[model samples]
Target: METKELLKKVKEIELKTRGLTKQVFSGEYHSAFKGRGMTFSEVKNYQFGDDVRSIDWNVTARFNEPFVKVFEEERELSVFLVLDISGSNNFGTRLKSKKELMLEVAAVLAFSAVANNDKIGAIFTTDQVEKYIPPKKGRSHALMILRELILFKPKHTRTQLDIGLKFFRNIVKKRSICFVISDFYDENDFYDALKIANRKHDMVALRLYDPAEKELPNLGLIKMFDAEQGVVKWVNTGSKKVRDNYTEQYEESQQKLHDIFRRSGVDYASLSTEGKYLMELNKLFLTRSR
Candidate 1:
């Protein structure tokens, strides 16, 4: 993309997303993710009906007046977006590719995080750690992330979900809300990593898919290509048996993903390229809030 065009796109996205965050998602986002815990703010003179346990004896002694310690919920939070940039994400039969949708989703979530006064960061990975943007708060920081998403080119084209999670675990010491955005086509054992991360930090998996992945069209005897493996083959889509077997394989993969998420106790949701992402996200936000 040209510099002028990229700047225009970034400004457009910022205008749209910032408005949504301020007007719509900010409240829901805040309510959905709770703070880690409360922290002491200050001490003030005890007022009527104050809790006895909250009284500061030393402060009271020094001031000769009943003083109590005041605490507030630590509202600040850190959000880590574990993004997948494998070659498979570049294919989509719908309005936008999986990579394109990822940029918008990441933008909205990043804005929502900053609107709640939280730090936002992301890891871009494709079979390896491509880049890691440390957590920071502000619209400028969020714009920088969006720019990277729009223009980043990876050195590799394969995926390693576990590698990204392990890096996230090692770098971020504090508990954070981690959103793993990916097609999740890898065969790696991410269960242990997920369990470890979820035990220490809150983790949510956003599975991105295109409708063509679930159902194949009847383009009889057409050529098919695997984006990741770069393999081409011809299949008779007119044959019912062949179509059925292909569908079964797809469903099996979906079920396996579902099972992994269920057993891991991590919140997971799927977004289809042909459908409304915001509606699905709102449902997930409300579900988490409840």
Candidate 2:
């Protein structure tokens, strides 16, 4: 993208997402995350006065004894956007590409953090740690983050969220609310990494996907390329059986991702490149508020 075009995209995202942050998302964002935030302190044997809702079901099931999750209320907070920049992010059949939607969603969250007077930082990754911007207050810092995001060139084209988590844990010492923005295109076992990160910080997953990812249209025989692997192949999209198989595989992958997050008590939400992100964001905040 040209310099002029990049500036325009940044300005446009600032206008739209920043406006929503102030006009629409500010109230709910505040309500949902007004308090510093919560981080897992530990899980110990359930005591007599422990709240039943705090029971750690998984721990209890594993140990054959009741354990209650303990959380420490944070007094100060930072927001981190751990973004994925794999080659696959360049694919989109919607109004905007997956990369565009990811940036927009990230902008909204960053602006929301700004409005709440919280420090915001970012970690860019594509199978490796690309960059790290330390958390700081001020809209200038936020805008700088947006600017870098627009022009960043990653050295790798694969997705390895585990590396990003390890980098985050190594750098950020305080309890922070982390937003992992990606399509999560990886087979690497990230569960251990995520669980460790969650113990030290509040982790939220923001998944971005494209409509064409789930169901390929019947465009007859067409050439398809593996964005991450750099493999090109021909596919029979016109075959009903092939389409069904594709959809099934996609849905299964989605379900496994959802289950992983939920089992670890991570807040997560998914949005399509062409969907109304504001509505989804509103819903996410509302649910978190409850």
Candidate 3:
């Protein structure tokens, strides 16, 4: 994209996403993902309703009065967006491509983090880690991330999700809320890495999909392209057996993905490219808040 066009696109996304954050996601996000823990704020005179155990004995002795250490919830967080920019994500049969949907969803998340006064960062990956933007706060930083998401071009076309997860684990030492945005279309096993990452940082998987992936239309014989493999093959989509097998494979993959998330104790939501992503995201946030 040209510079002027790219800047315009970034501004548009920022406006839309920032509006959504202010109107919808800000409060829900705050409730869903809390800060690291409570931190000591200051010492105040103990009140009648105050917890008796919270009274600081040293302060009480020095001041000759009961004083309790006041603590506040640390509301700052480092949020990481682990985005998949593999070749398969570029295909969509509906209104927008999977990559486009992913970018919008990620923008919403970035704005939500900004609204909550948290630092936002991203990891762009194909088969390998393409780029890493360290966490930073403010609207400008979020817009910078949006620009990068719009313009980044990966070197590889394959999907090795484990590489991205491991790279995130190695670089991000501080505990963070990591959102893995992808179609989960990899052939490799990333369960162990995902589980380990979840143990240290709160992980949420946002799986993107399109309608065509779940069901194939009977368009007679058609050429199908494997984006990751960079290969094309002719397939008879008119065959009932072929269509049934395709549906079965998709269902099996979905089941396996759900199983992995469940076993890893990670919260996840599937958003269809043709469906209302806001509803799915709201549902996930409500579930997490509870």
Worst lDDT window (10 residues) for model 3? 17-26
- Which regions of candidate 1 fall more than 4 Å away from where they truly are? 41-71
Q: Which candidate number has the best lDDT? A: 3
Q: Over all chains combined, what TM-score does candidate 2 have?
A: 0.85
Per-residue alpha-carbon lDDT of candidate 1 for residues 209-263, written as tens digits (9 for 90 to 100): 9988886678899998877777898889988888898899999998999998988
The clash numbers for all candidates, in the given order, read 0, 0, 0
Summarize candidate 2's per-residue lDDT along 1-290 as a digit string, tens digits.
Answer: 99889888788889988888888785787677655668789999998999999999999999999999999876456889999988999998879999988888889999999888889999999889999999999888998999998899888889999999999999998778899999998978788788899987889888888877888899999999988888999999999999999999999999999888988788888888886777877888999888
- Pairs of residues clashing in candidate 2: none
lDDT of 1 at 107: 87
Estimated TM-score for each candidate: 0.89, 0.85, 0.92
lDDT of 3 at 216: 84
lDDT of 1: 0.88
Clash total of candidate 3? 0
Off by over 4 Å in 2: 35-75
